[model samples]
Target: MVEINSLDENDVLFGVVASDRKNRWLGMHVDHDQTPPLPWWMSNPNQMPQWTNFLPGESNNHEYHGETRVQMRKPTGKWNDVPCDKKLKCICEININ
Candidate 1:
Protein backbone atom coordinates (compact mmCIF):
# COMPACT_ATOMS: atom_id res chain seq x y z
CA MET A 1 0.00 0.00 0.00
CA VAL A 2 1.05 3.56 -0.66
CA GLU A 3 0.81 5.84 2.38
CA ILE A 4 0.88 9.41 1.30
CA ASN A 5 0.39 12.57 3.31
CA SER A 6 -2.85 13.10 1.42
CA LEU A 7 -5.07 11.20 -0.95
CA ASP A 8 -4.41 11.81 -4.59
CA GLU A 9 -4.80 10.19 -8.02
CA ASN A 10 -1.43 8.46 -7.62
CA ASP A 11 -2.80 6.25 -4.85
CA VAL A 12 -5.21 4.66 -7.32
CA LEU A 13 -2.48 4.10 -9.83
CA PHE A 14 -0.14 2.53 -7.31
CA GLY A 15 -2.85 0.19 -6.03
CA VAL A 16 -3.35 -1.15 -9.51
CA VAL A 17 0.30 -2.21 -9.67
CA ALA A 18 0.48 -3.47 -6.09
CA SER A 19 -1.89 -6.39 -6.44
CA ASP A 20 -5.00 -7.75 -8.01
CA ARG A 21 -7.63 -5.28 -6.84
CA LYS A 22 -10.46 -6.43 -9.06
CA ASN A 23 -13.42 -4.27 -8.01
CA ARG A 24 -12.55 -4.44 -4.36
CA TRP A 25 -12.39 -1.61 -1.84
CA LEU A 26 -9.13 -1.39 0.11
CA GLY A 27 -10.69 0.93 2.71
CA MET A 28 -10.15 4.56 3.64
CA HIS A 29 -6.74 6.22 3.94
CA VAL A 30 -6.05 8.06 7.18
CA ASP A 31 -2.99 9.30 9.06
CA HIS A 32 -3.04 9.54 12.84
CA ASP A 33 -0.43 12.08 13.88
CA GLN A 34 -1.87 12.60 17.37
CA THR A 35 -1.08 9.31 19.05
CA PRO A 36 -0.38 9.92 22.71
CA PRO A 37 3.01 9.00 24.12
CA LEU A 38 3.65 6.81 27.12
CA PRO A 39 2.73 8.37 30.44
CA TRP A 40 5.56 9.47 32.73
CA TRP A 41 4.39 7.45 35.73
CA MET A 42 4.72 4.11 33.94
CA SER A 43 7.44 5.18 31.57
CA ASN A 44 10.98 3.90 31.45
CA PRO A 45 13.39 5.62 33.81
CA ASN A 46 16.30 5.25 31.50
CA GLN A 47 16.60 6.65 27.98
CA MET A 48 13.43 6.03 26.02
CA PRO A 49 12.53 6.79 22.46
CA GLN A 50 9.29 7.36 20.62
CA TRP A 51 7.59 4.39 19.01
CA THR A 52 8.85 3.64 15.56
CA ASN A 53 8.45 0.91 12.94
CA PHE A 54 11.59 -0.47 11.41
CA LEU A 55 12.37 -3.40 9.14
CA PRO A 56 15.47 -5.26 10.23
CA GLY A 57 15.66 -6.87 6.78
CA GLU A 58 12.42 -6.59 4.88
CA SER A 59 11.77 -6.08 1.21
CA ASN A 60 9.98 -3.22 -0.48
CA ASN A 61 9.04 -2.45 -4.04
CA HIS A 62 10.68 0.93 -3.83
CA GLU A 63 14.44 0.69 -3.88
CA TYR A 64 15.05 3.96 -2.04
CA HIS A 65 12.43 3.18 0.63
CA GLY A 66 14.37 0.94 2.96
CA GLU A 67 13.64 -0.09 6.53
CA THR A 68 12.17 2.65 8.76
CA ARG A 69 8.51 1.84 8.23
CA VAL A 70 5.82 4.18 9.49
CA GLN A 71 3.84 3.46 12.64
CA MET A 72 0.20 2.34 12.47
CA ARG A 73 -2.18 1.90 15.39
CA LYS A 74 -5.19 -0.34 14.91
CA PRO A 75 -8.55 -0.14 16.69
CA THR A 76 -7.45 -2.98 18.98
CA GLY A 77 -4.58 -0.77 20.12
CA LYS A 78 -2.09 -2.95 18.31
CA TRP A 79 0.57 -2.05 15.78
CA ASN A 80 -0.51 -3.38 12.39
CA ASP A 81 1.88 -4.52 9.65
CA VAL A 82 0.79 -2.23 6.92
CA PRO A 83 2.83 -0.40 4.37
CA CYS A 84 4.13 2.74 6.07
CA ASP A 85 3.73 4.45 2.74
CA LYS A 86 -0.08 4.16 2.59
CA LYS A 87 -1.95 6.91 4.40
CA LEU A 88 -4.62 4.83 6.10
CA LYS A 89 -6.01 4.35 9.60
CA CYS A 90 -6.64 0.83 10.87
CA ILE A 91 -9.90 0.86 12.75
CA CYS A 92 -13.37 -0.66 12.44
CA GLU A 93 -16.17 -0.57 14.99
CA ILE A 94 -19.52 -2.37 14.82
CA ASN A 95 -22.06 -2.29 17.62
CA ILE A 96 -23.52 -5.57 18.76
CA ASN A 97 -25.81 -6.88 21.51
Candidate 2:
Protein backbone atom coordinates (compact mmCIF):
# COMPACT_ATOMS: atom_id res chain seq x y z
CA MET A 1 0.00 0.00 0.00
CA VAL A 2 1.03 3.57 -0.61
CA GLU A 3 -0.16 7.11 -0.05
CA ILE A 4 0.81 10.21 -1.91
CA ASN A 5 -0.05 13.86 -1.68
CA SER A 6 -1.35 13.75 -5.18
CA LEU A 7 -1.97 11.03 -7.72
CA ASP A 8 1.04 11.17 -9.94
CA GLU A 9 2.47 8.13 -11.67
CA ASN A 10 5.97 8.77 -10.44
CA ASP A 11 4.91 9.41 -6.87
CA VAL A 12 2.85 6.24 -6.81
CA LEU A 13 5.80 4.19 -8.01
CA PHE A 14 8.06 5.57 -5.35
CA GLY A 15 5.48 5.08 -2.64
CA VAL A 16 4.99 1.44 -3.66
CA VAL A 17 8.68 0.76 -3.34
CA ALA A 18 8.80 2.51 -0.01
CA SER A 19 5.77 0.66 1.24
CA ASP A 20 7.27 -2.68 0.24
CA ARG A 21 10.49 -1.87 2.03
CA LYS A 22 8.75 -0.82 5.22
CA ASN A 23 6.02 -3.48 4.95
CA ARG A 24 3.38 -0.83 5.49
CA TRP A 25 1.97 2.17 3.73
CA LEU A 26 3.61 5.44 4.64
CA GLY A 27 1.03 8.02 3.69
CA MET A 28 2.83 10.59 1.57
CA HIS A 29 6.27 9.63 0.51
CA VAL A 30 8.81 10.42 3.22
CA ASP A 31 10.86 12.17 0.59
CA HIS A 32 8.14 14.75 0.14
CA ASP A 33 9.35 18.25 0.75
CA GLN A 34 6.75 18.89 3.44
CA THR A 35 6.28 15.40 4.85
CA PRO A 36 5.26 15.58 8.47
CA PRO A 37 5.82 13.09 11.24
CA LEU A 38 2.93 10.85 12.23
CA PRO A 39 0.84 12.73 14.73
CA TRP A 40 0.92 11.72 18.42
CA TRP A 41 -2.78 10.89 18.30
CA MET A 42 -2.12 8.27 15.56
CA SER A 43 0.81 6.51 17.15
CA ASN A 44 0.67 2.73 17.62
CA PRO A 45 3.65 0.54 18.48
CA ASN A 46 2.17 -2.87 17.75
CA GLN A 47 1.16 -2.35 14.14
CA MET A 48 0.55 0.23 11.47
CA PRO A 49 -1.76 3.01 12.56
CA GLN A 50 -5.27 2.31 11.40
CA TRP A 51 -7.57 5.23 10.76
CA THR A 52 -10.72 4.92 12.92
CA ASN A 53 -13.56 7.02 14.30
CA PHE A 54 -14.63 10.41 13.10
CA LEU A 55 -14.78 13.69 14.90
CA PRO A 56 -18.17 15.37 14.73
CA GLY A 57 -18.64 17.37 11.51
CA GLU A 58 -15.49 16.02 9.93
CA SER A 59 -15.53 16.27 6.18
CA ASN A 60 -16.69 13.14 4.35
CA ASN A 61 -14.33 13.60 1.46
CA HIS A 62 -10.81 12.27 1.68
CA GLU A 63 -7.85 11.94 -0.73
CA TYR A 64 -6.36 8.76 0.66
CA HIS A 65 -5.20 6.04 -1.79
CA GLY A 66 -3.73 2.53 -2.07
CA GLU A 67 -4.53 -0.81 -0.45
CA THR A 68 -7.21 -1.06 2.24
CA ARG A 69 -5.52 -3.92 4.03
CA VAL A 70 -5.94 -2.56 7.56
CA GLN A 71 -9.16 -0.62 7.79
CA MET A 72 -12.26 0.15 5.83
CA ARG A 73 -14.10 3.40 6.49
CA LYS A 74 -17.87 3.23 6.58
CA PRO A 75 -20.12 5.90 5.13
CA THR A 76 -20.93 6.90 8.69
CA GLY A 77 -17.22 7.73 9.15
CA LYS A 78 -16.35 4.86 11.44
CA TRP A 79 -13.39 2.68 10.42
CA ASN A 80 -13.04 -1.01 11.17
CA ASP A 81 -10.91 -4.00 10.15
CA VAL A 82 -13.50 -5.38 7.81
CA PRO A 83 -12.23 -7.68 5.10
CA CYS A 84 -12.33 -6.31 1.58
CA ASP A 85 -10.47 -6.57 -1.68
CA LYS A 86 -6.82 -5.61 -1.36
CA LYS A 87 -6.93 -3.40 -4.37
CA LEU A 88 -5.73 0.10 -5.13
CA LYS A 89 -8.90 1.53 -3.57
CA CYS A 90 -12.40 0.42 -2.57
CA ILE A 91 -15.65 1.40 -0.87
CA CYS A 92 -17.62 -1.00 1.37
CA GLU A 93 -21.20 -0.62 2.52
CA ILE A 94 -23.16 -2.76 4.97
CA ASN A 95 -26.92 -3.07 5.30
CA ILE A 96 -27.87 -2.30 8.88
CA ASN A 97 -31.22 -4.03 8.54
- How does each model score on TM-score? 0.20, 0.21
For model 1, residues 2-88, the per-residue Cα lDDT tens digits are 222233432443354345322221222222221322211112224322332223422222454332233223221112223445554
Candidate 1 accuracy as TM-score: 0.20
For candidate 2, the lDDT comes to 0.29
Instruction: List, residue by residue over 1-97, the lDDT tens digit for candidate 2.
Output: 3222233532444444444442222221111122332211112333423432323422222334321233313222222221224333432223368
| CA RMSD per model (angstroms) | 14.0, 15.7
What would the TM-score be for candidate 2 when compared with the true structure? 0.21
Once fitted onto the true fold, the runs of candidate 2 whose alpha carbons sit more than 4 angstroms away are 1-68, 83-85, 88-97
Instruction: Please estimate how well model 1 matches the true structure, expressed as its whole-model Cα lDDT.
Output: 0.29
lDDT of every model, 2 decimals? 0.29, 0.29
